[model samples]
Target: MHDESTKQPCCNPPWEPPQVIPAQVRRVNNLIFRKINQFHRENNVDNVTPMHDWIMSYLYWHKNDPVYQRDIEREFSITRSTVTNILQLMERKGYIERQSVPQDARLKRLILTEEGVRVHEKTMLSLHQTDEFVAGLLTEEENAELLRLLNKLRKGLE
Candidate 1:
């Protein structure tokens, strides 16, 4: 005797709409990427590798140890071809050197050249300055909290 379309609702779900909070971290990351690209473009240093490659290369250089291409691939979750291309470009730019291991000629070890070391140092200094500038507006506790939250997010993703 009842029409399905006219059946009464068991309950009206609480009509709480989802709240939209400002994603400050996303905004900051986008700003940083933009600034880095702009800086590189203005300096005519955009070639040789992408911004991310430069960052990874710098980190490897600072570590001051021979690294395997497989390590880079694993750490960055990048494709083999992409890693090879970046390494080749960096090698051509004198930013890195690739040497075959004695025991296994098929495997290669990557070392940052002196020029790469200098570049890494300068880049790190600039990055530190930028970090200080950004954190200047935040209270110490806020800065710590931000780092903690970021770490938690990163771990969750991993």
Candidate 2:
């Protein structure tokens, strides 16, 4: 005999398990993509595709250093030909220039044009906005822990 107090509550339902890690990661990735797209739309940056955006970001990071096609290939895990094709397209679009090194005539250094620098600055601002939005969710300690955990996971996978 069940006591009245112990009887099943009609208002409460059984809890389902939390989403798997991969699903959660995918959802987070989708959110980041959506935020970036929103930023692009708000900035009237419709001409910059995601690939162009990524390349611009990389170039910006190496703006002071001498960057080469092979550096991009190794960093991105993409083929040399793929890097060359993307660089060629970027060059045609007036985003970057390939200049021969006087010290190494065979080497062509990647240099961003004025237009590229402008675009890179804007892109960094948008990314910082997105980063701040996420950073606001956690304390400094939590943020550091999160980064540490993510790096650990990446290293384990690699």
Tens digits of per-residue lDDT for model 2 on 29-138? 78987887778777767566666777888888888999988988887768988888999999998989999999998899998899988877777676777788888889
| Candidate 2 stretches greater than 4 Å from native | 1-19, 103-106
Quantify how close model 1 is to the true structure by its C-alpha RMSD in Å: 5.5
lDDT score of model 2?
0.82
Backbone clashes, candidate 1: 0
Provide TM-scores for the models: 0.68, 0.73
Q: How good is model 1 by TM-score?
A: 0.68
The Cα local distance difference test for each model comes to 0.68, 0.82
lDDT of 1 by residue, 1-158 (tens): 87999775787544433332235656777787666555555554544234434545544644666578887877777889988988887778887788899999999988877877766655555555557767887999999998998878778877
Q: Pick the candidate with the highest TM-score.
A: 2
- Model 2: lDDT of residue 5: 92
